[model samples]
Target: MLRTGEQYRDSIRDGRRVWINGERVQDITKHPMFKPMIDVRARIYDMAHDDATRDVMSYEENGERFSVGLKLPYTKDDWHAKRRATDTVLEDIGGVVTRVGDETAGEMWSLYDGQDILNEVDPRFSTNIRNHIHHVIKTDPFHVSANTDPKGDRSKRPQDQDPDMLLHVVKETDAGIIVRGAKYETAAAYANQAFTKPTIANWGNEAMSDYAVGFVCDFSSPNLRFIARTGFAGRAPARDYPLSNKFDEVETLVVYDNVLIPWENVLFYQHTKAATFIRATLHRYSAFAFVQRNLKLADMLIGAALWNVRQTGLEHQPAVQEKLATLACYREGINAHLTAAIADAEESPGGLLMPNQSLLMTGRVLACSQLHHMMHIARELCGGQICITPDVASFEDPEAGPWLDKFYTLNENWASEDRRKLLAYARDLLNSDYAGHRLTFQLFAQSPPFAHLAAVYRNFDWNEALRFTHKSAGLSDQVWGDKR
Candidate 1:
């Protein structure tokens, strides 16, 4: 079922403990640091009910309306609808915000595809994942992902150092399993639940371990604390840092001190195969949305750069045009991957339609790996004015205002105020503290760069290339006989 903005707001007011800037946030819905993102999420919910957006944002099933973002995929049309819904939200919000529900919900779908691996541990585990997927659709709660434990020491085993360094099943009780550890999660402070899981890729020969655990963590449960990074909203004026003030999806280090995960919420446990399978295939479905965000980011870069050049009347320069063309290639490269991924969509092991794995994985690499260079190109196009611009307050000052206006105004059409606003926007998009954090966040958020390559390696058709090379070289059939 669908929820309204106010209902979504009231749901998260469950008195969950959240700390930021050394102060306990009294109301996340009202706090300056969190309220912006919280309102964005709320607006997303509201969009589903609005007359103009309802058709695009939700689907009807059995006489009940549900969020299109949470609906299980069955056909190519479903994916197109999901893409449109996400794009509509981005356009409506006027900026990119990744961790809002849709992008993270598909992580659960990946586990749902691994029911066979889950069944080896416990049949109930498979059942739990299926139930939770439907529960998300039925309840329409704001969900996020939890992976990447603090993992204190790389050299020492978790047992040697602090055992709680990695989140593990500390105790199994009749009521539930109590976990103790922390995870770096974006939007956890305001999100309703998380599909908590392991990040370990290699299990070696070991079988059962405490770290091999996955569950749905209810944020309101006791013994949970959300310690968020200080936000950019209240620290600076919105006029000076537009994107930062409205679009920062605050990251949190969530400490789970003996938190309980009931049997119904547990998706898997004590199974290395389940953990390994999840790590390898975690982004199979979710990467589509993640890479889609990069596409939107690319658009932002292109728009900012092109507008800067247009304002300066450098749009006709061959050199400037070439850089713009490069940005377009980057944007379209991502567009091609996303579009083809859907056109050549494949059915998951669980019978759900997912973006073609090879295309999607490679697209993620292209989008994320080249983002920094793309940002640099855009920065170059915007020139030096973005970084050297004076603050809005300085422009408004009695003594400095006239001098700043005289220097900043380019023509009658481009006034000093307009120039100042553009530079402020470009600075926030590429040079502010928020800009650096966003870059790093995109770099490692889904997984690290190496993991992106590893995914491509696993999904790409290496055998095809090998067979073609063997045929072209006229290798003997005996070479393949032994391998076959």
Candidate 2:
């Protein structure tokens, strides 16, 4: 049930069409732009087999070992094991990389919780979702998510303009359903499959439509193309941009031109109720992993800022200490939410244990909404040296090397080379092109800011607050009316 790194690499070499920088990538496993991320994913798979990590990364069921990330949750211990596995991977990799697998797999679990709604339309649709969840555990393939479509116009209906703007069921055949459209997905180029679905939340009074479709898209199928954004690995030396070179997860615009989805792969079809249920509870479990990434990012900010002050001997300043405390508060705020969510875990409608929804949703808002300001605080603490420092080439130059060394060296313990490396790291983490892209990616990746608030509104106990206020005000029983 578990795959090796080489086996995982070989599985994606199925001759799928992928384009980046105006060139067709023949081997994604060997290409410079994609190879770094592929290697990271491969390393994660290898960790499951390693003697030291096998216990933490995998679980035994019926004499077979399976990935802990893909296992269906049943108890609180299961969630703790999953969290440890993800944290171990992040520590092993030495940086944050979302969309690897565990973070996106839970999206399918959300749909699995809606089986009753799915059964309302057809029992087969519910059966398909259950089969796919087990299939993922049995096969251990790399999976991702597909939701956002390149909806061309907001004012015009899909029928009035280009119908293909939003992904719809173009034709249903005896063999399968052929779909034509595109979706902006991260890691889809290298991932094996995606849980494809719609982003529309409101269905009004309509009960069925072509856009209300969801399926498991096999990336190796024909008529599929992956157009990726240019990567940051080969563009510069790894010494100058450490994080960018090793951790940039390239995003792709995956185009589906008359692609076929067999009946077995279809999770739901022509049912707006299923689509509505999915969008409402999409991130219920996945948000735990997504917000966990922000926690790691917060650590990066704190590490860079604290080290900068230590090098300059400013750690003794009260003002500097206050800023460091602020960063700690942000980090612990996320920690509290994640910890309490698990402690107060609730059972899903499908009988699976999920993190407390209210805490998880509110945690997502706290982590994402305050990220920009946290980055700014860290940037200020690092000073202007991060942006004004010269490149590695300038430091190694014969004429400029001596002058740069004389100016950059602070003490015998802090040499010019180490100083240069630190500034370069700080710059890449907060000021470079990669930094900006990562910030925007986190801002809108899971959904938009407004959606985060809406999730919190729906999950929070508003009735509890109303009941307390009514009792404190000594309101009459008649005033309660049917509100209770």
Candidate 3:
């Protein structure tokens, strides 16, 4: 069922204990740093009820309305609908937001795809995953993922360092399992729940271990705290840092001090195979949304760069046009991957339609790996004025206003106010401290570059290349150990 914006705000006002900037966040919906994103999330919910967006954001099933984002994608049409819903929210909000409900809801679907693996571990565990998927659809709770733990020492085993380094099942109770440790979650502070699981670990040696556990952690549970990174919002004037003020999806280090996970919420437990399978396939569905964000980012880069060039009449230059083309190519490259992935989508083991693995994984690698270089190109195209520009206050100063206005005015089209705003926007998008953090987030957010390549390695059709090479080289039948 769909909810209104006010309803979503009231839900996160559950009095969950949260801290940011070394102080308790009494009300996230009211806090300067958290409010913008929370409101954005709420607007996403409200869109499903608004007359203009309701048709796109929600679907009718048995005369009841449900969020298209939370709908389990079983048909090609379902995926198309989901894509349109996400795009609608982004366009409506006027910027990109990755951790908003739609992007994260797919992580649960990835686990849903692993039902067979989960069933092998325990039938009840598999049942838990399906129920949670249904729960998301029915309740439309804002779900997030929790995978990475504070692995105290990279070389030392979790037991060798601090047993609590990696999140583990400390104790089990009839009511639920008590878990201990912390996870780095992007939007857990204000979100409803998280699909908590193990990080990348050597789990094959263990047949049974406490570290192998996965559950849906209700954020309102006791003994949990969300310590978020200091946000970019309220740090400066919104005019100076538009993207930072509104679009930062604050990352939080959530500490679970022996939190309880009820039996119904536990998706997998004890078995190493279950943990391993989840780690390998975690982003199978979620990566699509994650990479889609990069597409929006490319657009932002191109827009900022193109506007700056046009303000100075550099658009006619071949060199400038070539760089603009490069950014466009990068943007469309992501578009092509996303489009073709849906076209060549494959059925999951659990019968859900998944984007073609090779394309999706490689697309993620391409989108994320080259983000830094693309940002640099855009920065170069924007010229040195983006960084050397004066503040808004200077432009408005009585003494300085006329002088600044005279110089900043470039022909009748571009004026001082518009130029200052463009430079400010470009500065925040490309050159500020917030920009660096966002770049780091893109590189490591959805696993590292190495892991992206590993996914490609696992899913790519290597046999096709091997078969081609064999035929081209005319290898003897006996030389190759084959069924033929």
* Tens-place lDDT digits, model 1, residues 413-459: 99999888888999999999999999999999999999999999999
lDDT, model 2, position 40:
98
Give the runs in model 1 whose Cα sits over 4 Å from its true position: 481-484
Please give the distance, in angstroms, between residue 99's alpha carbon in candidate 2 and its true position after superposition. 0.4
Candidate 2, residue 420: lDDT: 92
Task: Locate the minimum summed-lDDT window of 10 residues in model 3.
Answer: 475-484
Candidate 2 steric clashes: 0
Model 3 Cα RMSD, 1 decimal: 1.1
lDDT of 3 at 395: 86
RMSD of each: 0.9, 0.9, 1.1
Model 3 TM-score?
0.98
Off by over 4 Å in 2: none
State the local distance difference test value for candidate 2.
0.93
**Model 3, span 1-484: residue lDDT tens:** 7888888889889888888888998889999999999989999998999999999999999999999988888888988898888888889999889888777778888888888888887899889999989988998888998877888888888889888889999898999899999999999998999998888557657788888899999898989989999999999989888989998899999999989899999999998888888888888888988899899899999999999999999999999999999999999999999998899999998899999999999899989988999999999999999999888888889999899999999989999899999999899989998899999988988888888999999999988887888899999778667653
